[model samples]
Target: MTTKKIIQDFYKSEAFINVSEMEPYLHPEFILEWQSSKGFSKLDKQGVLDLTKELSASYVRSKIRILSLVQEKNQVAVRYSHFVKTVENPREEMLLAHFFVIWEVKDDKLYRGYQMSQIS
Candidate 1:
């Protein structure tokens, strides 16, 4: 698959809370640098997996809307909004965050990512 397609699919899987499906797309050394309201954190692939699993326990559902996407060579940049509904308040959906991320593809898998997010 194309790098762009792979990146897009990753986001889709995340929204669906399919962490296991997302793993195959990641390189062993995959890492993400995240900048957020709290501060910055560097996360390895396992860290991301753990985070997602934790989030799944609190949120009943989630959605991702990609506002912009661009791919150059093996790199992709994306801007997206994330929405989620907590298990305690399933009827009310809330904006989780807005994100801007750049991912580097290696061996047809996501090798590195850098992202910033604004919490809502």
Candidate 2:
């Protein structure tokens, strides 16, 4: 599959909501760098998995809206918003974050990414 399609499908995948389903879209060496008002943080493949697991445990429902996604060569830039409600308040869908991320696809999977996000 093309890099663009791979990245887009990854976002729309059930893996986005369920951490256990993430393997197919991730490279073995995947890493993510996050920049937010708090500062910069990084995550390796295992860290990503842990994070998603924690998020899935904490939130009852989740949704994503992809505002724009563009690719050049093996890199993709994505602008998206994520909404979720905590387990404690399942009926209230709140903005989890709005994000801009750049991902590099290698060997047909997401290898690395740099992202900036803001909480709403």
Candidate 3:
């Protein structure tokens, strides 16, 4: 599958329902990044997993809707709306942003990825 397809599948995977299903899209050295109103930051893939694990307790569902897709060379930039439902709050809210992701893919392995998400 193409990178886009793989990424889309990751969104639809059971991981969104149960955090443990995240294995397919996660690599040991994985990295995930996103910006808040404060500033940009970095998270190792483990950090991403940890965040999800913690969130699983409070957030019942998570979903990403692709708004746009742009690809050049080995990079893919995707604009999306990240939707989440808080277990306690029970209200779903969305944060719209675009992510710039650069991946180092060697054969079937994804060695690393750097991602940046900005408010849109």
lDDT by residue for model 3 over 91-119, one digit each (tens)?
A: 75655355555554433334466666666
Q: Quantify all predictions' global Cα lDDT against the true fold.
A: 0.88, 0.88, 0.63
Please say which candidate is ahead in lDDT: 1 or 3. 1
Clash totals in order: 0, 0, 1
Q: Rank the candidates by lDDT, best first.
A: 1, 2, 3
- Candidate 1 residues lying further than 4 Å off, grouped into runs, are none
Q: In model 2, which runs have C-alpha deviations exceeding 4 angstroms?
A: none
- Relative to the true structure, candidate 2 reaches a TM of 0.92
Model 1 lDDT at residue 92: 98
